[model samples]
Target: MQWVSLGDTGSSCPAARSTVAAFRSWADSYLTQPSDELGRDGPVCPYVQPSIRRSLLWLAQVPAADPRPMWVRAIVRDALEIYPELPTRNGSSTSVLRALITVFPNLKDHTLIDEIHAEFKTKFVERGSMLGQFYPGCDQPGLWNKDFRPLDAPLPMLVVRGMMTTDFPFLLDKPEWADAYVRKFAPTLPAHVRSVMVGRLTSRPALVPAYEVRPDDESCSTSS
Candidate 1:
């Protein structure tokens, strides 16, 4: 379960070499470039280029030929444990750009990918991280374009990254999740954006003004 740099080819899994190659190709051709389908002005993932340049992107391949749910869960838990130790540039400002992509090369049961994502998402979010599921024929649509499946990828995989201010959409519907988001980013968000977030919360919690909190303190004890 060791995480490797994108160029590493030392894995023992039979498909690991090819699967990692495919991921690298996809990343260079699709993720690092902008697409009309995205309905936006930048690369598919705006952080990807910087992640690559800073050498903060790492990949791990699950060796199971036919992965079981319990095993995949275990792998995901391992990944969560490994994420915080990943390297970054400029500290917190660029740490959100860091990513760990865990690939399931031989998994054919794509539905299990979704299940694993649902099971681990809460834990990841509470730790100030986001978990994303990606697989072929994935139907999860892009935020800006309904027809675009930004989550779709050639192989089944889960990705983890430090949550960013732009993740409000994912947090807005759930009160607890929204509170976590506010506690993490409230000090950095624009006033209008904070207003919009407050308006969208289902049950708004009284947020202590950011000024009252120490600048180095990223978490708000009162918000939780």
Candidate 2:
């Protein structure tokens, strides 16, 4: 639950500070700039620049030397508990720009990190948040291009942020996840996207969401 601004990680270990510094550089140079290899005409992460400008990006260190699964899970649970209290902008669409990165500098087990990410991602999505797992040499591929690895950061960390309509691609494959997306964005989804969701829902009639998705909620464009 120990959150710190990128500018200061008070009393944090040298390893923690070093990891934070590396992430700062990565966000500044890589995330905030466009790359030809990315197969898109924007930065690696479009929200990053606004996030940095608004001072909504935060970092937390899990100073665990042993890296046991139970202990790591405990820190992650704490992070989830505090995520709602993190700073956010005034507009509903603006909340998605904020991010909380929980770093595990001392953890050497990349497999365990992946396991934890997989185990917790559902819970995050259910709560209207997205959790991203990043570690050195991670093989997860980029969205627009299969060859690009957008998530291979210099450290092992989990990032949490408010979910946006742009996340529909990630949710469409899973019924419960798609249900969550529909619950939040059905009212504002573009016609094509709604058609896709309707097709998906009809295909699995038995797995339909609990609520009768009504087209009445805040407006969120596809670009959001």
Highest lDDT against the true fold, candidate: 1
lDDT of 2 at 60: 77
Over 1-224, each residue of candidate 1 has an lDDT whose tens digit, in order, gives 66777644664355567877888788889998999999889989877877777767788888676787788888889888888987666766448878889988778888888998888888888888999999988999898899999988997889999998888878775566776887888799988778777566523433434223334566657764
The C-alpha lDDT values of all candidates are 0.80, 0.79
Please provide TM-scores, in order, for all candidate models, with all chains considered together.
Answer: 0.83, 0.83
What TM-score number comes out for model 1?
0.83
As for candidate 1, its clashing pairs are none
Best by TM-score: 1
- Looking at model 2, residue 34 earns an lDDT score of 97
Which sections of candidate 1 miss by over 4 Å? 7-15, 89-94, 202-224
